[model samples]
Target: MIVIQAKLIFLNQEDKQIVLDLMRRWSSCMKFAYKRLLEGYDRKTLKRDLQGMFDLNSRYVDDAIMKARSTLESARELGKSPKKVIFGGRDLFGKLQKRHINGKAYEKLKIRWQEKRKGNLYSRGDKSKKGNLNTRIEVRKNGTFLRINVGERKYVYARIEAGYKKNKRREELLQEIAESNIPYSVELKLKNGNIYAYFAIEEEYPEIKITKEKGVIGIDINAHPGNISWTEVDEKGNLISYGNMPMPELASGSKDKREYFRWQYAHEIIEIAKKKNKAIVIEELEIKDKGKRGDFSGRKSRRIRHSFSYKSLLSKIKTLAKREGIEVIEVNPSYTSIIGMLKYAPQYMITKDISAAYVIARRGLGLQEEIPDNYMKFLNALTVEELEELKEHVKKTVRNKHLKKKHLREINKAIKFLQSLESEPERVLKPLYGTSFSTYDFWRVLKVAVVTPLSPEKVPRDFSTLKELLIQGKWGDP
Candidate 1:
């Protein structure tokens, strides 16, 4: 019952110009839809509102509404510079792209990309103001080739053998695609002087297993404009290796090259996960302007928060993980950087980011960190007289005297504090005369949830629900 889907893309050169023309027309349609949105037309009513405007098919018009609606909504949510994601598709391609899964009324963007941002990249679409027919670009497929209707009964075909079936792994994918019964979608994309046919094929009866015993490879992502880091750890929270996998020192204006390098690292990580037969762990962080309105956190031109493309990296990890039969887990990112800064840097002898990544990996592994030095100072903050008074208070509480709940907790904290210094004279004496940190939040470390590292007596013994579901690709449906 596990349904998974992804794109199968290939270069389409025969009717590249025809598809490109359609893309431009699609962008025009999307802009018109954006104008209507700004005019207070809601998504549900766009069908009746802009009925004959684009002159596209009924379904294509719906597709425009969805795509345009999505484009505007995402721009608002992420505060991305581009409010208009000028993209196009119709009919089957429309259904597959899922241009707009969530529709909403979008606000006007002050900083819009008005074609002058990057030469003639978008100006051409603006000039091609004429509406396009629905049949200009059509999507169709059976068992052999994916056919696209360009114009005047002309069609372009993307053969499976010329694309995915050429690879050994993709050849298997083709077989699974042939046997699957679940629904699927296909698309055509024109990017940077190239055209790619994308098949969003669904995977039916997928096998998932959450493998135990095998240690996990916990990774910490540090995305920055000029500084990126990654750290790896085992299931026992033992450090295996760590360094900056997200390369920052790239040639200027080499976005594609930068992406290729990132793909390389992603590939290597998946290989590691596959070889070790373990799950991949990483943090889930969003990249956006979280500062006050119009006040993004950054320097003159360098925004640190915007630089953290943690979401994109996580997407790559998950996509590759699914392909390689590996598990991907995302954990909370709270305090990983702070804790790493305090203790991990000195202990691991690594740089700032690597230290943070080490802490991140251990956090993903569910390993409780050691008590920080500040906490120990706080534990020893109380004087001998105060300790004696606290001890007396504990005795008074047991004498049937009704006390507030806070009093009981304070008494328990006092007992736990005293136990740590019971046998050590230096620990008690130093605090008595020397300065110590004053705080009341010692439960931070004491109450941490932990999965004890595997040992002779610490193996996982619970498997009551193992047969119901399997993940990490260890076991699958027979």
Candidate 2:
């Protein structure tokens, strides 16, 4: 049978108290019935015994016990042994012959249980007790009106009408039902003085699969504007440019930090790829000087050092990728930027171009190419403005024409580093520096001086010595 999950909300205190009392009475009645059964009375005969003792009308008492037995049997099959069953003594055989309780009365009972279930009842000095008696109840929803009568005077009346609806709301509800486990189980909870009864539905796990082919994309993480670049290549190793998304200037200086934006964008892209059933290929980044002071001059260095958010972005991307079923492959990022620069080396500068071209040529011929430290020096010397200008130049010049083989190779190589940065920089950092450092650590680890124990009288007594020790320990420099 299809079961719908529904909740009941109580309107006032009077309604709430009435429901609580009904539950207590019902629980006591069930306990008495069970006690009789344990005393060797048959299940049906026990109901007759309860009918006589409670002065309950014979028909009502018999029906209540039978219904309680059925509920108990179902609960047992479902691996649950209910402590007690709740229903009205009078209503079971009276006018409203509903099988399962619902509506306002059910909600009221639910709330009373929730409030009395928490904590020890009495203080150490007082003998007053705590904790309400345990009782089990069921609610069934059939129509707009919830009708339940617990006893002769205690009854609950409420409406089960929709709260609000948007376009396609029912469709969304249907989807949720289809995806969810049928006959879902939830803990019925009620809070005193609260207008609504709460049900905490257990989370259901769904099966997930990746349905598309594998694709690799490069990501570059930054402090200001976090960027990710994608390069889609076909099976034949040919480049596909339509898939690339480059972020040239992601404002890195904002105090608000852009980790949230990066997480949102990455998840968006990853989800798109996941829905398409494609695997992602990414480059590995090696971030160095993670727990170190900024290299900028004077006070500006200190100020700039405080603004890194690299670690937060990487963490967010990794979590999202896992949820999307993206397979991230890490490739070495060494010399990617340098190689990319060399590939675009200007034709006007023949000597330098040839030197840059030679690096790609050797790699293409399956020969090992040595990376010079000068490349790093060159990169370090290029100001942020110059890097931006170079990016603009490449964008403007490389359009509407075929890129040279040398330049294309370099760009592909640099793209690997960018991919690594975008996908999982920690993977790259682990191999290169033996430690994963990101822009986020600038605030967490490097901003403070490491405390050193002193023999009370041997205080360093100088800020420079403290700074030197901190730098030597790789925390930061003055």
Candidate 3:
């Protein structure tokens, strides 16, 4: 979607106040609807109640509820408590409550806070309304204008100016609005005593041109090293090329700067794919909130959680890929890291992250991964007696080395998988891919049992350290 920002010029104070009044009521209804939604009210019920409680009509009320619902969903996704969310600017609210600084400073802050709280309006597009009924934009012979519906058959007219600079995107959007019946959403905001209108229109994308039939470039986003690693593979699943893009400023920069860098990163990857004439493959990975308030998550966890915008970055990549007609493929993220570390990293002598990218690329090509013969033989040799001894070894290592809970869990899970296999020697575990290969559980057993403790972070970057273990079927010294 493309968004056009323009200044709204009102002819008279009365017309401006009419729009302002609707914005105030719309903001108020939004807060009320959010509270009711949190208190177990459905959208239908809240829509009816908001119309009665606020001055807004049905459509405005619906839009308010939509905005509030989106805010709530975002908060939940970030693992934030809804109760702690400040409707306006939280920092400004805190400053005002503290009563710090007097006179002009205080007044300026108060005005900004009030504007943030009550000076916003939103109206969704409706195709049946010829675009949008509440806030409609039309280009006439004289100039472009906006007709805003404030109340019962009451309307306010304002001139809209998109500025003097040349903007091809804006011009294209305007042409689309004038030529097609496609709906466009509008949002009005009062910024610094001036009214700004944001118009959003969806853009059509071309058909897929570059596809996996030729090759695929797989991407792996790593947090510890703060780099995006990519590996290109041929149609036969052979590695062709690989590289890493370091993003040192991604975690510590300002929000705007970080977002700009993300766009640049996406552009770089897409350009590489275009150059190679290959499709792009990335894991469909979802990074949920690291922890809640007062959870005392570690510094690394917090930094990674706040710094990386996985969804945003992935969306940007996919959007740009669509515009470039490059096919983008998303594969299951499960065990990509483990499979990469165990199977590909040692064999290819590459970093774990790059190895993971290789696995992602190969998976996109519809290839099945087979367990190494040596590793399979080791699993087959493990009896309940041997598993018990390994369990004792893991427990001793954990107690002596003071390993974290996660390490213990990993080792224990692997041991359990080994125990399950003792009963069924010829057992085959099938995953969602519906292949006759062993499940990730079997791999995890090998990882903890034989691959030098097999933790992604703890394992040596030179995966050759574990080469002897994998080749000789000898368990690592825990």
Candidate 4:
């Protein structure tokens, strides 16, 4: 049995209430089932010895009895008497049989439960929240519904049901989650700024994969004046072809909305290439220097900057590649964009033409070999007439160097702040200092001071903000 966890985000008060009620009822059912098991005439004490069993052993009826007895003795030593011991339902019990199985089963069951609960809740109410109700349930085919109780409160129960019939919808959601590379865990936590029978599916890590591969492909993300520059290579480290793709009409913001469509196109291309069992090579990008301004002055520049999800795009490519057993590698992007332009002349005029260059460079590198120096030099010298074009290209290449430097400085400052926080032990700053402090403690420290500081709350959020700031800064410090 596998338990998969999911989150259910309710839209309105009514929906929220319905979900809460369902969760409580489900918990009560589990409690009821546990009580039944306790009262059975099996000639064994369920409460006396069950608690002493290891989690796995206690999952079984007979073993639970033995464990309870042992636990009772231990409790006596601490001046406490063992009380009623409740067992989880079949699904929960099966989950406890093994750690890995328990986790997976929990998720599957959670997703399924949330999905079913959503339908039931929606049927009862007309008005909901801003977004559609998102439900996550775990699925385990053989698991039976059960309930458990603790003291006067009954909790932890589930209703078994058939799988959802919407294969396409499920697949689409799964794809979205996968592409986002978001690994989440279901946590029973507060919702809507209040404590309730709500579960939070929190993202554990940024769904991004950074790899070091021999070949490098340059990419210039665009919304207006759309274009991409690419350079391909063969196994012998020889440039095969280089070019760019232009979005001529994009300069006026008409093509701004096409970014998602472009991603879809790129995704399709990658998918087809995957079928041929090929590896993808791309540039390694770090958006550290993005906070600095750029040439695009007005709101249009801001919109263009906001529109590109380069990280997400790269993330999708890596994820799809991994699923298909194709390798995705990143090489120093450095000056790939500029170099691509110089190498592929007529091809560099537009962005779309870059795809041809990408194929050539990918082939030339043939899984091993650094991007050649000549290409880098060519890129360094390549010039663009449009300030937006220059800024975008430079932002992709030179800006990385700035980010790399700032990141190191931030780390040093963060260490001091963390040590101070740790030294003042009784400050009750745990909430202020999140659980995963080590990952982004420095940024968190910065955020406490500013309402909307230059830095963002998280890495991805920061990246987006920084891009805009950088582009905006290009006009003036304001």
Candidate 5:
């Protein structure tokens, strides 16, 4: 959607007062609708009652309800209670409550607060209603004017003074509005003693042409390290290029500034895809609430988990890719990093992040992964009794650290994979490698038995030393 804002010039004080009164009534209706929605009222039921309950017409009431519903949904997404929300401005409300200022300053604050509390009017677009029903724009020879239906066949007119020069999006929208029966939503807002009209129109996304026929760029977003790693692969599944970019701004910045960086990075990534004539591939990362009220995950871990906006960055990438007509492929995120660490990292002498990107690219092209022979042999070297010993050792570490229950499940999974490898290796191998012994199972077991004991806090980024350990079949002193 594209939004264009324009300043409204009232013809006289009477028209301005009429607009203000309408805004006040509209905002009050919105608050009423929001309260009803919170009390289990549906849209149709509220739509029927709001027209009769409020002094406004049906169209205005509907728009108020729509705006209220949007605000309520936003509150819910942030895990905030709608009842606790202050409609105007929470900061201004607090200041006024505390009586922080006096005389002219206090009067100014109160007016601003009133404007925020009662300064919104919205009109949804309709093709049948000539772009908009209640609020329609007429571009006349004298000047552009807005015709707003107040109520009972009464209307108020205001002149529009918005520049569209040099703005291709807005220029195109004006042309579309004039030539075709295109619908555009309008929101008239009163801010700082002036009226502004925001016009929003849906844009058609271009058709996707760039695809995996050439190859793909696999992206690995590492939240803990605050960097994004990517690997380019050819159609034949061979690595062409690989790189990493750090995002220190994401760690500390204003919300708008951080959003700017996100878009900048997204554009850069898509430009690479465009230059390579390839599709973009990334993990379909899903953030789950694994931390409970009494979990021993620690504050540092929770901060790292919450501070990073994994979905936000990924969303920006996908949105930009769509706009640029680049195809995007999302693969299962499970074990991509671990697979990269055990197999690709050591073999290719690359960092874990880049290796994971390589794996993602391969997966995008429908390529299957095979475990290395050394990793297979390393798993074969461990007996059932030794596997049991490693399991017990992992349990001891978890218990000593007071980790969550999920860690206990992970220890069990690793031990079971090893037990299967020690007994009927073919059972675990057939699905992954189509062979008698599952090679992939060995790496996971190796992670628990070998890697965890050496570095309990986190996985090492550099896996150069892992090559020798896997080759020599060293289960080490765990």
Candidate 6:
């Protein structure tokens, strides 16, 4: 179920007000229903009297009542405490947000839709509390142009490209379903003040493949843009691929653009899992950078940390995996990186980050702590010239391609360091190819992952003192 956002455009004030009225009524209905739910009123009781409680059409009233019940029920199942949901819930944008019209309503709202170019059908918040629920719109897709209905049709709606290509993904999904697939749900959203739509098309069911699985892929997320690290492993807990794939890095950009990059990166990781027919594993972090802000706090750091979008990444991967019938496992995130740093980094001559991924994969597989003794075979076999060439390969290929020029001086400094380590940087940082290629703090955090069981949350960002600690062999064999 992929959600697409489009700016719900309004051509006139009257139409906007009409939408506003419908949403207000919807909110009234939700309030009534939620109150009844709290009073121990069952769905039957609420549904029976919903139309009388709100000045809305019967279908709209039914949708509001049923959806409210559903919302409260789901919260209860998840052990969430009951809280009053405000009108146009902050997450739902507006009242019309939960309204779902069946095929009959769609037919009533549309005179005609050119399936090939676009479809003009009217909708309000379909039930969402995000973006801009500016007005109700009949979203069009993939059309050369949009034609506005100025009372020519029964409804006040704007024509748009059937598949708004701003989100090319929506276009693709719409195209895919144009044939014989059934859509599970279609949602309308007020996304960032723009009218957007989410199209969830159901695919044909396939034969069940796994009662149990052997292979697993583990992933670790970083706060910095494009700092995702992952590894693949076999059933025996043997590492299959460590730092073999391109790291997906979001460049410094707009929020929408950054979200899109993270999405594309998830797809790349999913592709690897699909190829291996393995389940996906990732650290199940409930909190991010909790209580870690410092005295020298800066706006940029705060924004970067806050906007990491870990939840979105997990959501995207899970949705994709579900359709493909793959399993996703979330392991405890605490100390996975430290364990990786100690156990797997040296074995594969990779950075602590990738080693963390390796450990995550192993933990999901229910494997023990031991690393394969011969894991270093590939690194040991590489000659000095090959090692230097590999170092340069990362400096140019991965580094130049993934790192943003905004941090060029810092990146160049790190690249120059990699160049200096011509023969063996592994003795210091894990294999440059695996981790430190993108991370600037190879000496500090990675070293902690190397020796200490789990570095204090307040480990100095500066590496000078940390470097001295590492040289003293205070932690691990490294």
- Model 3 TM-score? 0.85
Number of clashing residue pairs in every model?
7, 18, 0, 84, 1, 31
Q: What TM-score does prediction 2 earn? A: 0.29
lDDT of model 5 at position 395: 66
Ranking by lDDT: 3, 5, 6, 1, 2, 4
TM-score winner, 5 or 6: 5
What residue runs in model 5 are displaced by over 4 Å at the alpha carbon? 81-83, 89-110, 163-176, 251-256, 283-312, 366-446, 469-478
lDDT of each: 0.48, 0.38, 0.80, 0.37, 0.78, 0.51
lDDT (10s digit) by residue, model 4, range 1-478: 1123223334346644544554344333333334444455232444334334321122232323333334444443323323433232335444445545546666765554443322221111011321111222333343322121211233344432213332344434433543343432222322333322222223333433322243344334444445545454434444544444554433444445655555564676465443433446654533322223433333433443354554555566655556555556665543343333222322233332363345335433543223233322322222222222323333454345755344434434534454555543431223244433342342333322221123322222112332222233221122
Clashes counted in candidate 6 amount to 31
- Model 5, 296-316: lDDT tens per residue? 244433543465676788888
Best by TM-score: 3
Off by over 4 Å in 6: 2-21, 31-44, 55-59, 65-200, 203-214, 224-226, 244-251, 274-277, 284-307, 322-327, 346-349, 368-478
- For residues 53-77, could you state the per-residue lDDT of candidate 3 as single tens digits? 8877899999999999999887775
Model 2 score (lDDT)? 0.38
RMSD (CA, angstroms), candidate 1: 17.5
Residue 248 in candidate 5 has what lDDT?
Answer: 89
What clash count does candidate 5 reach? 1
lDDT of 6 at 36: 80
lDDT of 3 at 334: 65
> Candidate 2 or 6, higher lDDT?
6
Candidate 2 local lDDT, 73-137, one digit each (tens): 65443333345433333333333345255788766555444443320011011112111111112
TM-score of each: 0.51, 0.29, 0.85, 0.34, 0.79, 0.50
- 66-87: candidate 6 lDDT, tens digit per residue: 6667778655533345574443
